[model samples]
Target: MSSKSSSQFSTFKDCLARRLISTTDLDGPEGSDDPLDEFTSYLASEVWPALPDTLYTASYESLSSDTVLQEMASDPFYISLDAIPIPTSFFDTLTSYTHFEDAHDCIRFLRKVLSDYLTEATAPPPVWKQTRGEKCEICERGWVRLTYHHLIPRSVHGKVLKRKWHTESMLNSVAWLCRPCHSAVHHVASNEDLARYFYTVDLLLERDDIQAWKKYASKQK
Candidate 1:
């Protein structure tokens, strides 16, 4: 790539990073919705519009064959979205393509790969034990037929844990709790909030609503 092209790419990356960080900062303690989803939407709506026309002509073959993208997809890392490296060859191939379909395919591939990587990098560790019939961890309800609750909601974190960590069960990343306690958690917070703040039995219990629910649920038979 020419020096000018490299500089443009660098500038784009910087801009993207700034946007992502700003978005993340906006996530208050009460918890926002799925951050990864928000990020992806930003790329599609905001970043795509600002990119050079060449980026819109990129081919699937080029994207699929990009070594860096493949490696990142297989062994994903947790980094600011803007810091992700795009290869010069990938850009070159994109610039050579004439069909919009090619570009669309490349974009889809990139979104899937990046989403998978981010999901894996941010996912919580899974629980391994199969401790059944235990006291509920949250409500301390004895003999209540406990169910495993993912401290981080599974919809947001489970994909990564399953893909990268080979986590196949709620036991891989959960606290044993009764049905009411488990349901109460989802009722109060979003997946992003659970992943960021309530990703532990103690933390979940610390929530005023959760605490109130625990007190109420514990009184049941």
Candidate 2:
């Protein structure tokens, strides 16, 4: 990349960082900004690191980390639309290095991160006392048996042909939500709000600070 190109790329990165810090959501108008130029420029400048070229086959726990999440939240360049902050650089790195040719892989990656984090902390559900007869984590209801909900929507992975869960894909992700609460969180929160909540949860889970997490979650609701 020429100096001019490098400068432009830096500008995009700065703008994206600003957006991550300031924007509440990504959609319609805000989501359509050109990231291709930024990504190509980054690659050319060799600012981006080499990706893991093989499929990320590690278990979910191996890739997820509360520390990574805290870093993202504190980096001033993250807006959570899902549990993971979406950025062109992330996807580009995936495609460039790992076996992330589809949406399924991406979604799987998201799941791995969140699930692993929860496992590491053994953090109880946000409403553990309310759980009865196997309450679903996502829904916060006692009626149905619980299944994991990916904070990042699976729909985004529609393009993957034969998707499977792999470690790289799931790293720095979240799981353990019942279906309803999961839906409420994903569907209701704006991107920026989602990012904030994810960060809040990381902090709360790490410190076992349920009260603080509750305060933030309640405010979002």
Error of 1 at 3 (Å): 42
**Pairs in clash, predicted candidate 1:** 126-172, 126-173, 127-171, 127-172, 127-173
Candidates' C-alpha lDDT: 0.53, 0.39
Which portions of model 2 show Cα errors greater than 4 Å? 1-133, 138-140, 155-167, 171-176, 190-221
- Given candidate 1, what's the lDDT at residue 187? 88
* Best by the lDDT measure: 1
> Residues 56-119, candidate 2, lDDT per residue (tens digit)?
2112333245445444323322323254335665666645544567655644554444333223
The weakest ten consecutive residues by lDDT in model 2 span 48-57
Report the number of backbone clashes for model 2. Answer: 21
Model 1 residue runs over 4 Å out of place are 1-127, 131-133, 158-171
**C-alpha displacement of 86 in model 2, angstroms?**
41
lDDT by residue (27-70, candidate 1, tens digit) is 32134476434443444344444433333322232345555544
Top TM-score prediction, candidate number: 1
